[model samples]
Target: MTAALLAGVLAGYGIAIPVGAVGTYLVSLTARTTLRTGVCAALGVATADGLYALAATLGGPALAAALRPVLGPLRWVCVLVLLALAAWGAAGAVRRYRHHRLATHAGAAPVSPARAYLALLGITLLNPTTVIYFAALVLGSQTGDAAGSGERVVFVAAAFAASASWQVLLAGGGALLGRMLTGHRGRLVTALVASGVMTALALRMAVAPV
Candidate 1:
């Protein structure tokens, strides 16, 4: 249970830390609207992550077994994916900064809290990479019986909590986050730091007991 919780938290933060389009939108929307709406949107994102984590936990063992023979190479593939994710995250941040492509949703009217929640949920659900990332991490897992009913609950709950906490933090930041992301140096520094942390995490995975 402890291992599952730890892994779940790490996995949640692992994916959420990358301030991609959705994250930027969440922060930007909050700065433009109310905290209530932002929090709703944050939860929506967390819900999608929770759902994907649940799917990964439920299907991982069987998938892992089927791929056991090729798990070796797949682990390497996962490593590459992680690296690519890190690089892309950094590069995307830079691009957005350079291109002035912040998700302003310019000229769009403000959405209500409920609408914000549903919109964010649908947007997040459309991201196939989120599920693939979770699935790949689950395949490489050796911590606990992720297939167990109780553990799955714990794992999913932890993942949701982790993601929710971060998303909420971003929403809570409001103008501060918006300013940080919009500022030239601040955005670059933040992106570089996030990428570095993720790279470290990927390297740790590369050396996990195999």
Candidate 2:
């Protein structure tokens, strides 16, 4: 049990610590919105991680094998999704800057906490590689060769908690950034930069070997 707990925590941080395109989006989104919304979104990400971890624990090696067949397609889909998000963010930033007023993409309503949560959850779920990552870890480490049900449960819970804690910390940092960059120009610059990074990341993902 202790081994499972330790391994699960380590696995969670191992995956969550890598701040990629989604992480950039999370921070930028938080900077544009409220801490409450950001935290909810962060939880959404953690929830995805937890679900992946659970699948890995339950399915073991077979999960990775099953995912391998669709890996390339999934990556393409993820790239498209990320690119769309980048375009929307960039457009929204420019529009808001020109009008000197805060607004969301396409005149959409401001992101509520619920909306943010669902958006983040959907975005995170697009990356099917997360499950493979968890599967590899579970097969090679976490719950060992064959984890019992109780051990699997503990591992999943620990992984979720670890991921949640780290994501919340990131959201807090983004909130701080929002406070610091209160001016329109500052927000505009930050948003554009984030959009640029997100675009580059999406393109990079598209070109990466599957």
* Top candidate by lDDT: 2
lDDT of 2 by residue, 112-185 (tens): 99999999888888775575577567567535448898889888898889988988888999999989998889
Candidate 1: misplaced stretches above 4 Å? 61-109, 142-146, 175-210
Cα lDDT over the full model 2: 0.83
Per-residue lDDT over 1-210 for candidate 1, one digit per residue giving the tens place of the 0 to 100 score = 897888889989988888765676677567646788899999999999998787777666665455446545655555665566568657766765677655333234456889989877876665534645765776778533435787788888999999999999989986566555566656656666656665775677578754
TM-score of each candidate structure, all chains considered together: 0.61, 0.94
Question: Model 1: which residue pairs collide?
Answer: none
User: How badly does each model clash, as a count of residue pairs?
Assistant: 0, 0
Residue 32 of model 1, lDDT score:
47
Q: How large is the C-alpha RMSD of every model relative to the true structure?
A: 8.0, 1.6
